[model samples]
Target: MECCREPSCRKRGRWRWRWRRQSGSGVNAEEEHGIKKIILIGTPNVGKSMLFHRLTGIYATISNYPGTTVEVFRGRGSFENQLFEVIDTPGMYSLLPLTEEERVTRALLLAEHPEVLIHVIDARNLEKMLSLTLQLLEAELPVILVVNMMDEAETLGIDIDLAQLEKDLGIPVVATAASKGWGIELLRKRIAEYVRKHGVRKGVG
Candidate 1:
């Protein structure tokens, strides 16, 4: 019988899946209750590094691509009145590693098993950026999608329906102008919620 149609399989897997979701949430609370380690990820030049600095107040070297600097940075941030160890990873287009940096980025994602994985992307290029978002979900990472460069999107007459996007992805989607300090707090709150709801300490995924 097909897995979806199998009663016994559903009975066995449903609670296990629910329990895994709770595990992720628990990990978030664990951090609040004194846990650390969150990782930020995205494609190149999408503002992942900038967001890291904004959230952590520590600057990492930033530059343009094609002779651009692609390296990960580590920092710290607090949300929901709790501290966290935050890591900003190198830009990666996909998990099926293509470039050296992409391979490195994928390795980090697999090994770190971060409590929260923030996927920062260019809001103007949502169509293109979402490919990575889908891939993240495929990897079973606890991912939150951040649409960075909202200001630019507005200037270009590109309106992103964040609610609709969230519905499509079944994940929290936040629009941010990271450089201008917009949406950072809300982003923090959502991150905290996801962490509290999904982080393994809470018995979530």
Candidate 2:
């Protein structure tokens, strides 16, 4: 079932098995009405969807972006008493918009102006993915870094100094293996705290 020679296709195929194991019909009304907005952006196969499911406790509602075939996922979740509207954008390697999917994601980011933007990255490819993080920071967007797939990185003998990475990036960084449910609680805490401190809009009770 090779879709194409693109790396994204291969990665998506590799994780197809996990998709069947997922439960829940999709996002619910409570999750849909969150006051704060959190957008998850990352390259394909970086566990962005898995993290979204974890945060929202439901599968994302997949829909085509306006006037485009590209799909974006949206759901809602609560953390530390803060309700958040979470958007899992299509996989994008850069904000430069080489593909239609990237173009949609780039437009979504600029237009939504979310209270907290979470950039999920593969732990094994940290250095490579940091370029996008830098791009986000350069744009002056509120960003939080999620170093996902730590379990795989550990299996490959990669050790990340999360505190150091957080200091270097000058933003909150959370280490997690979203598939295994590791570090999700901490990630939730960080998201809640970040929003409370920097959120532009007041949370709706």
Candidate 3:
């Protein structure tokens, strides 16, 4: 039985996705509800939705391989009195888009200019995923890397040297097993810190 046939199933890959901007926010993220926008970005099936669900308590299970997210979901989460408007974007491989979903995500980044981009990636596929991370940095977008699915990676005898990665990227990189709830709090802490450092609202001219 193909589970994706159902209306509620998340496996429809790169179809029926829509990008919408919120209304009534004239100010930057830090001022409005102290709402920092944390947009999730990565190639398909890198555990983006799983991290999204873990962060927001929203249920959105995505598929594997050609496993693009079919829709974009937004939700809010808070940590230590700081609130965030978390955005789960359609899965895209790189800053340079090849698909509609990729285009929409890249366009959203330029238009919305979110405070921080959480680029979730599989721990097992770090080398391939780092290219996008480099692109985000090149584009001067504030980004945080979430190295997810560590449990599976460990089982495969794959150990990532995160500190070395941080040194190389010049940005914060977090590890997690979103399915197991490991490294989530640390991710939140890093996010809160990133927002506090970078999400400061500028004075209106």
lDDT per residue as tens, model 1, 7-96? 323213422332233343334432333444577888889998789988888623222222335555656677887677577877888889
Task: Name model 2 segments beyond 4 Å from true.
Answer: 1-34, 201-205
The lDDT leader among the candidates is 2
**78-137: candidate 2 lDDT, tens digit per residue:** 788877778899899988999999998998887666889999999999999999999999
Q: CA lDDT, every prediction?
A: 0.72, 0.81, 0.74
Q: How many residue pairs clash per model?
A: 23, 0, 0
Q: After superposition, how far is residue 97 of candidate 2 from its true place, in Å?
A: 0.5
lDDT, candidate 3, at 190: 92
Best by TM-score: 2
Tell me how many residue pairs clash in candidate 2: 0
TM-score of each: 0.75, 0.81, 0.77
Model 1 segments more than 4 A misplaced: 1-34, 59-70, 201-205
